[model samples]
Target: MKTKLFSALATMVAPTAMTVGSVSADAVAPQTSKADFSVVAKDPTNPTDPENGTLVLKSVPSFSFGTIEASEIYAGFTGKVAKTAGALEIADIRLGKSDWSLTADMAQFTDDANKLTGAILNLDSTGSLGETLTGAVKDDSPAVEVVKGNGKHGVDNFKMEAATLTLAANPAADLAKDESFTTTINWNLSSTTPTAPTA
Candidate 1:
């Protein structure tokens, strides 16, 4: 009976070994492929009946006067025709002003520099009421003169006086169409030496 039992167990183990030996092995091929595409389009056209947009414009006119490039200070001396009181002052000055005309040129639009124009004058401590200062462009022969004094005084110890630039509509009117603009003026001052004052 023991030998029959041992024989049955050996038969069971043999079937298990045979099943393990029947395992299968295989190899898979790698996939290799590429994809391609292209794009084609056009911009949309504006509507024929377009709405008019509002344009608000603003600007400030300011100018700067440079220092006295050339100046002459004379003390009291005798040869002069008449005796002058205290010290005498002689000043020669030059100045400039620039109008920054900013325009929002949209959708094939343009604004020319000729549309905007102005003048600036140089002022000093000695600027008298109703004094007229002149300026000119380097290439242009036309010179612009600005008048001083509208009852305004200097702010501090500098003794600088207030002045105004009278701009015409024909020259600078077109710049008013933009949202904002600015005008900057610069000036120079100079003078020659004077004869010594006499006692």
Candidate 2:
């Protein structure tokens, strides 16, 4: 009976041991296997060549004032005109004082002087604000002066002070009969520079 029991135990153990050895052999085979790789030559030209093209940079600066007109007027009379009874007509008034303001476009250029020299300034027009008297003066008259303000620069930007307009008498206009005066105000960017304010 002991001999028969020993024989049955050996048969069961032998098959279980063989199954474990088969799994172990499969795992060891992966460790001994060799992996193959390859290397190729690099292309002579850059991959991003077409996308990395050349670029050109240009600087354009310009400035202009708002459409200005005679908003208010105050006239004074002298010697003989003071004794007149009735008020003077708007057309006939002489030696009158007028006040007007221009809604200035200050953000056209980073520098005032550069904007004036780079482009022409016109009144209420977009294309080359030319120095033309839109109201009652000729085109060639030198009746305007380009006034510049104190320049202030912050970071990468700069601004100029308010440009004041002065109207001088036209040389060709009639002095005696024609009491009307007209002039053009040009914001010249050619003379813009950073400076301290005057008291």
Candidate 3:
């Protein structure tokens, strides 16, 4: 009887088994991919891909002043402006105030024979989220910086309105009748390297 009572007491006092190994979880840095930039188009309908974290110059506007009459061609004569032809778009996948610069320059208007002498192109911006990108681009000089900085905090998609193009210079001579001329407006973008935030 005494032995049975001792056994029961020992069984009641037995210890429970336990596992003692360590368990852990880990995290890694985020990977960012960029989307290829599309050709500049007026009234761009391309969607921003924040998922790809694209920090790029998405598109720039292609303006049309339409056909001009030789008699009416003069300084400050901006021909019949096409509707919604000057919306420049940017794609940003960034942290904090991401700095960027957009520059523009123009080529001389050319006919089949020669350049249209003394003609200048001026871009007038009506809307901008940050810095206004309005400037004149002469064929003789380097591109002018139109806008600098996002004019906002953090990453975002932005639209810079380039409202109209004014013919700032008069041709030295009268344009030949029925002559059509073409020119190019070159655009460039600059991105500053970002620094990580610290506590």
Q: List, in order, the clash count of every candidate structure.
A: 16, 6, 0
Better TM-score candidate (1, 3): 3
Candidate 2 collision pairs: 112-189, 113-189, 113-190, 116-189, 121-129, 122-129
lDDT of 3 by residue, 1-199 (tens): 0000000000000011101111111111221111111111111023343333334454454333434444344333553343333245554455655576667555555545545444444556533455565676665468788766644533333333344444444445334444445554555555654322223
- Residue pairs in steric clash, candidate 3? none
Estimate the lDDT of model 3: 0.39
What are the RMSDs of all candidates, in order? 44.9, 45.2, 28.3
Ten-residue region with minimum lDDT total, candidate 2? 3-12
The Cα RMSD in angstroms, rounded to one decimal, for candidate 1 relative to the true structure is 44.9
Among all candidates shown, the one with the greatest TM-score? 3
Residues 65-112, model 2: lDDT tens digits: 222121111111111101111110001011122111111121111111
Score every model by TM-score.
0.21, 0.15, 0.57
Cα deviation in Å at residue 40, candidate 1? 46
Q: By lDDT, is 1 or 3 better?
A: 3
